[model samples]
Structure formats: C-alpha cells, structure tokens
Target: MTLYRDQALKALIPHVNDRDIVVAVYQSCFDWLQLNPRDLNYVAVGAMGQASSHGLGLALANPDRRVIVLDGDGSLLMNLGSLVTIANSGVTNLYHFLSANRVYEVNGAHPLPGADQVDFEGFAQSAGYAGSHSFTELDQFTEALPAILTAPGPQFVSMEVMPGDAYPRDYAYIHSAGAREKFRAALTRG
Candidate 1:
C-alpha cells in the first residue's frame, strides 16, 4: 500500500519546529498540515507547480533555517526545470518532498501523464541534488524522514502517496494575501 499523505505529514511534523518554513502547494498539503496546528510558518502557494521554485527562494534567502517543499507530482512536472536550478544553487538547507499520488487529485482526479513510469528520484539525482530518495511504504518513509530532514542537503524525496479525501475549497484561503501578510509578520517577528 502506498503511503497516505496525511500520515506522511504527521511523520514529518515531529522533526519540524517553529523555525522551519514549510512551502507547500495547493489544498491537500496545506489542509493536512493544519491537522495538528502549531505556530509553524508555512506558505500555501495557491498556484499548482510553483511550490518548489518559491521554496527555493525562501531557502536561499534564509540559509540559516530549514525550508521544506511539500510538492505534488503534477506541480513538479509543470516546473521540472526548477530542480536543475535548485540543485545548482548550493542551498543545503532545502528539503524537497514530492507527494507523488499520480493523479491531480484537486483537478477531479486527472491522472498525470507518465506518472507511474517517471523516475522522480533519478531526475533529481540527474539534476545534481545531493540526496535523492523515493519511498512507497509508510515504514520506509517514517524511517527515512528524520535523517532526510536533518541531513545537510539539497535533498529530494519522492513519496508515492495515496490521494487524500476532498477538503473544502475555503482551505485555499489560508494562503491568501492577508494570510501571507500574517505569515510574513510571524517570520519577521522571529
């Protein structure tokens, strides 16, 4: 069985404290992270396919802090070139996590082209990421997450996850301009 997205998020949470910035794409990732809310800083990049790039910027700008990219397969496919740039940017604090569920779950469950055949980890390696991993099982994911989060990297972890249940559309509002202002304010307050 594939890892569930919510469980994957839970496994990662313990390792992430308030100082870490989570740049996640779309509703599912944002909503799941909200399950056990804390004063965790997050950016819900409302646009699909933009989380990696946006997270890269934050990682580069804040080299002292860890930046996690909670990306999706469809989003990654849309901006594969960002991987090349990220690999070369020398940002060791960035951890890229792909929720590779194979379908664009938000877009009415549209299956991504070649999603099953794509070697996402290999692509990251080819782009020169210092660490590249793929996990399809929950045990492996749990076992690897701590090290992945703690290790100095431009780490790329591709998780083959099962699609989560539908969330309300209002979940998107968490990253609205006002919310972004609040997120910015929180980061600056630190």
Candidate 2:
C-alpha cells in the first residue's frame, strides 16, 4: 500500500526543528501548515515549481542550517532543471522531498502527464545528487528518515503517497503579504 501524505508528513514533524528551514508549495504547503506550523516554514505560494529553488537559496545563505524542501510531483516536473542546478550548487545542507501522488492534487487531482512513467529518483540521481531514495512503505520511510535527514547534502527522496485527511485551505494566509512578512521576520531574527 502507498503511504498517506498526511501520515508521511506527520512522521516528519519530530525530526524537524527550528533550525531547519522548510520550504513548501501547493498541497504540501497546506498540509504542512495544518500539521507543523512554525515560523521557519516558508510557504511558497503563487509558484508552481519554485520551492526547491527557494530552499537552495536558503541553504546557500545559511550554510550551517538544514534546508528542507517539500515539493509535489507535478510541481517538480515544471522545474526539472532545478535538480541539476541544486546538485551542482555545492550546498550540502539542502534536502529535497518529493510527494509523488502522480496527480495535480491541488488542481482537483488531475492526473499528471507522464505520471506513470516518471522515475523521480532516477532523475535526481542522474542529475548528480549525492544520494537518491524512494519510499512506498511508511515503516521503511520512518525508520530511514533519521539517517536520511542527518546524511550529508543534496539528497532527494521520492515518496509514493495518496491523499490523506482533509485540511482547511487558508488561501488568504498563504497569499497574503502578512505571511511573507512573518516568514521574513522570523528568518531574519534567526
């Protein structure tokens, strides 16, 4: 059975800390907000595939901190070039996580093009990532997360998941200047 997105994210909460900068987009943004709301969380709104780029920037700027990017399969497809850019950027603090549901979940769950054929792990590995992993079982994912999160740089993980609990979408919050300001203030204070 495929992992549930919420369950996977829930498993991640204990591993994340204030020092870890998390960049999330679209569905992951909403789910993360609901599950682990924190000032260090950077919600990448109004962008289809920029979370990884943002995380890369954060990782580069704060070389001592860990930057985790929560990205969607559909969104990643839009910015496939980022994999190569990230792998070559020489930043070892960035961890990229792909929630592969094989659909545009936020856009009414439309099936993604090449959904069945895409090999995200292969793409990341080919693009020169230091490490690449795929997890379809929650037990394995949970057991391996600690090591993965602690391992040295530019790691990519593709998680096969399905929709989980429904979350209330706060569009106003995600799209507002207040949200950006809040994140900026928190980041600067850190």
- Clash count for each candidate, listed in order shown: 0, 0
Q: Write the per-residue lDDT of candidate 2 for residues 8-85, one digit (tens) a residue.
A: 999999999888899999988899999999988898877699998888999999998999999999999999999999
TM-score result, candidate 1: 0.92
For candidate 1, lDDT tens digit of each residue in 34-72?
664544456556566888898899999899899988898
When summed lDDT is taken over every stretch of 10 residues in candidate 2, the lowest stretch is 38-47
| TM-score of each model, paired residue for residue | 0.92, 0.98
lDDT by candidate, in order shown: 0.82, 0.93
lDDT of 2 at 122: 99
Between which residue pairs do clashes occur in model 2? none
Question: In model 1, which runs have C-alpha deviations exceeding 4 angstroms?
Answer: 38-40
For model 1, state the Cα shift of residue 51 in Å: 0.4
- C-alpha lDDT of candidate 1 relative to the true structure: 0.82
Identify the candidate with maximal lDDT: 2
Q: How far is candidate 1 from the true structure (C-alpha RMSD, Å)?
A: 1.7
